[model samples]
Target: MDIFTGLINGFDIALSGTNILFCFLGAVIGTAIGVLPGLGPAATIALLLPITYIIGSPVTAVIMMAGIFYGAMYGGSTTSILLNLPGEAASVVTCIDGYQMAKKGRAGAALGIAAIGSFVAGTVAVLGLTFFAPPLAEFALDFGPPEYFALTTLGLLLAVALSGGSIVKGLIVLVSGLLFAMVGLDPISGKIRFTFGSIGLQGGFDFVTMAMGVFGLGEILYNLESAMKTEIVTTKLGKVFPTLKDWSDSKWPIIRGSVIGFFIGIIPGGGAVISSLASYAIERKYSRHPEEFGNGAIQGVAGPESANNAASSSSFIPLLTLGIPGNAAIAMIFAALMIQGITPGPFLVAEHPDVFWGVIASMYIGNVMLLILNLPMVGLWVQMLRVPYGILAPVIVLFTTVGVYSTQNQVFDVYSMLFFAALGYGMRKLDFDPAPLPLAFVLGPLLERSLRQSLLISGGDLTIFVTRPISGTLIAVLVLLIVGQTVFFLKGRARA
Candidate 1:
């Protein structure tokens, strides 16, 4: 289909009553959760995953779900600028200069830059997705079992590498995720592998329960260790829009961040968090007034905020094109798609253009909605900070428990949730990131399935992964990643 024709059809579908309404609701709910610190997009989406199941249309459900993620990117800057609190991990870099701007009584301008930058960057990313996704999907149509196994292997490794922490620690958790995914019956043999003589175990872990426990409940539990306090920005937000000077200073940063984020977002594991951090570093490097960074530089706020939002938008590209979700939130959306019996991959654009293009079209509308929602209504979101985490935490706990139990009336599912919630809490305290775990869990079975198919095709020959052209390239890339990591690690040890 012609790109223009596809987009027009997409806009037509996106403008329909139901899609528009759900899109708006998703934006509103997403921003609300984002303004309320400690309930980031991933956890919020996990908590709300069941609701999407209740909705009939997969496109509408995804439109809403997608809105929550990028909307959170915009909303996260609210607390970062006003309270010096990062509502999402991706917003952490914004705090360095955003809060400093608030102290300087430029809170409103700081926020204006973030919102405007986010909107521009988001639009750029969607444009990138519009042009890039269809062709990538076309290219991916040729993938066979060998290519798929190799790709999954690379994806799992990239997810671990960019997850930001000790590589060894990430590997350990990654392996654990794969093991946990092996709980049910063997996919090909039809024999149970790890079920401990229990029917529930035979069915394996519930995705919704495990996700709710680890991300939703676990995050709430971890936040209970400290008191929630809002540091009020005393200065009046005199001008909510950036001046011409602020605009001039931020235009280049916004452009650079958009490009940086759109591409980085395509790589597995390099989502909003990494994009924002990378943008900040690049902005600092390019700044003529380097000292101004971390000291109220508008570029600092503009660049990272743009990058994070852009990353959030473009992260959809992989899922929509290659069937690889780049982050936790997108992974949840992937699960949602699976539940709806819609598998996103090379065939998505060709087979389900409505789901593919309607979503792209909705983002254009969603970004406009968010800009309108965030820019003028800054004061409304500020009010969200008043509700303390002490109250919010328990509310989330209660909400997730009910949501999980409703999925399966079994008390064991709730118990399973509680168990993972505790596991999430301990992992948090121990500096082991729980984000990669859920994603790994989701990918594990697919990886195993692909590996099995590839081996079968090659008559159990192990070199098939390196023998096929596309698979060989992917394997070569993985080899480079491993060698690169080893060299980097050795250099770090030597420097120490």
Candidate 2:
């Protein structure tokens, strides 16, 4: 079907009472969670995964999940403006100018412009997703085992390169995750690989449990080591609307940010944080008064806020079109679809049109809901910051435990979650990133299967990956990424 017809059908599904209600709920819940520092969209989605099962339809569940992803992004700027706290990692840059604006009694304007900018960027991203994703999916229909293997290889490499850490560390974590994923059984032979005489190991590790442990409980544990405090700006929030001058100054930055964020988000490991940082740097460089950046510049807030939200929305493209999630949050969303027995891939648009279009349509509705909700309910979001971490941490732990136990009424699942939680905590202490591990774990099976299948197709000839046009191009890209990262890593070390 054409884009227009597909969107029309999607609206038909998204406009239903159930889908709309869940979308709104997701947005509200996501915004609330985002107001709490360190609880990013990925952790929020992981914490809420079990609840998706109760939502009934796969499309409905996904509509809600998608709402949570981008909705958190919309609300993340709140704490940044009010308390100079980044509720989401992507909101970190917003703190520089947003908090300064708040101190100068321009908090309301900073937040209002952020909401407006986010809405505009989100709309742009949705339009891109509507038109761009389907054609990309159609193109992916040509992929075979060799192509898939090469693509996944490139994806894994890109994940490491963009991890914002040492490439060697990212690879270490990724390989560890692959080993973890090898437990249970070999896919082709159906022979148990590492069960070690335990029935609980028979099903392999549950993605939901692992995700909740690492992102939900582990994050809370990591944060507990640091003192959590909030000194909220109590200045009477001025008019909750940007002045004409604010809009005039911010218009171009928002547009530029939207375009930049959309493309960056399509790359593996590229998401809100990176997009926001890049947008801020770009805006600062282009600004007539570059020196005004860290003070009360409205462009600083508008640009990064818009970019992060735009990136969040466009990050869905790779997952829907290529069955590849670019980051941890998208990976969890992929897991959510798998829980519903709906696989995401190039054929997803053709096979599960309702899910694809329903999610896209819900984004339009969710953005409107966020804009309306954020401006009017800024006070409520601020109140969320007042809840003590002492009270919040245990509640998060309890909820994670309950969710894991409810999965199959099995104690083993809970134990596995606790195990990963401890492991996740240790990894954090060692300055290692836990993001790539779960993502690698999730992608390991697909990578292995593709590798095995490609070998069989080529009669054990490993050259098949570099022989095909698409596959060869992908492998070449992977090699370039490795070389580039190695050179960069060496240069930094030499300078150090």
Candidate 3:
């Protein structure tokens, strides 16, 4: 199919009353969650996944989820500038200069630049998705089972290597996630292995249940423990628009951030958080007046905000084209896609063009909605912050519980979510990143299937993984990452 035709048809689908309405709902909800500290896009999508079943259209469900992901990136800067608190982890870099700007009574300028930069970068990323995803999907159609095994193995290892934490801890989490995938029946034998004599365990863990428990309920519990009173900046915001000078200073940073973010977001595990951090480092290194960096530099605010938002947009490419999720949020959406009976991968464009193109197109509309929401209603979002976590926490928990129960109407599912909620909280307290676990869980079955298929083709030879061209290269890269992690681990221990 021609790219323009697919996009046009996508717009036709996206412009419908239902898709548009849900898209707006997702944008509003995503922005709301992003503005509220302790809740990020991944958890919000998990909390809302049950409703997608209710919506019943796979294309619409994915459109809404995509909106939420980028919308969270768009809204995250509000709290950073207004309260010196990061609304989500990706916004932490924004806090450095954003709060300083707010303290200096330039809150309006900082917020304005962030919104504009985000809009530009979001557009740039969507353009990248528009042209690149189709070709990538076409290229992936040639992959064999060995290649798939290598790809999934690489994905799992990348999750550990880029987890932005201790590699050892990431490996432990990765192994734990693989174990979670091992529960239920043995795939080839059709024999139950880990059920431990329970019927519910035979079906294994529902992805939605675990997602809500870990990302949604678990995050809330962890945040409530260390939650503190916060006050929005009291100084007046002079204007809601950036000045000529502000735009002049920010134009180049926004461009640089956009390019950097688009490429970084394509990596399996690197997403908005890492992209934003990388952009900040690059901006700092190249700035003419690096001394002004932590003291309210407009370039500091412009670059990271744009990078995070751009990363959010481009992160969809991997999931839409490669079957591998770009990050944890995309992994949750990948689970939602499966629940809707849609398999994302090379054939997705040919098999479900509506799901593929409608989703990509809806992001364009979502970006506009976010820009409109973030700009004119900046004040409204700040007011939302004043709604104490005391009130917010219970509401979230209630919604999360109800959402999980509604999915399968199974009591077991709710229990599973609560169990994961506890586990998720414990993981956070231990400084263990939960990102690798969900992603690992999502890819585990695929890796197993690929491994089994490759082995069958190679007559049970173990060398099959490294014998094929694509698989061989992927294995080489995987070995390099492992070796690099070893060096990193040793250096950390040496310093300790």
> TM per model?
0.98, 0.98, 0.98
Give the C-alpha miss distance for residue 324 in model 3, angstroms: 0.4
Ranking by lDDT: 2, 1, 3
CA RMSD of all predictions: 1.2, 1.1, 1.2
lDDT per residue as tens, model 1, 397-493: 8888888878877888899899889988888999998778877888888888998998888899999989889999999999999999999999999
lDDT of 3 by residue, 211-231 (tens): 899999999899888865667
Q: What digit string (tens of lDDT, one per residue) describes model 2 on residues 1-496?
A: 8889999999999999999999999899878877788788888899999997887699998888898999888889998888888888889999999999999999999999999999999999999999999999999999999999898878877887887887778999899888888889888999997888999998799899889988888888898899887665475678889899998999998998899899988998888889999999999998999999999999999999999999999999999999998889999999999999988999999999999998999999999999998998898888878788888899899999999999899889999999988988888889888888778888999999999999999999999999899999999998888888879878988999
lDDT (CA) per prediction: 0.90, 0.90, 0.89
Instruction: Give the range where candidate 3 is weakest over 10 consecutive residues by summed lDDT.
Output: 227-236
Over 4 Å off in model 2, which ranges?
A: none
Query: For candidate 1, what is the total of clashing residue pairs?
Result: 0
| Residue 57 local lDDT, model 3 | 96
Q: Estimate the TM-score for candidate 1.
A: 0.98
Clashes of each: 0, 0, 0
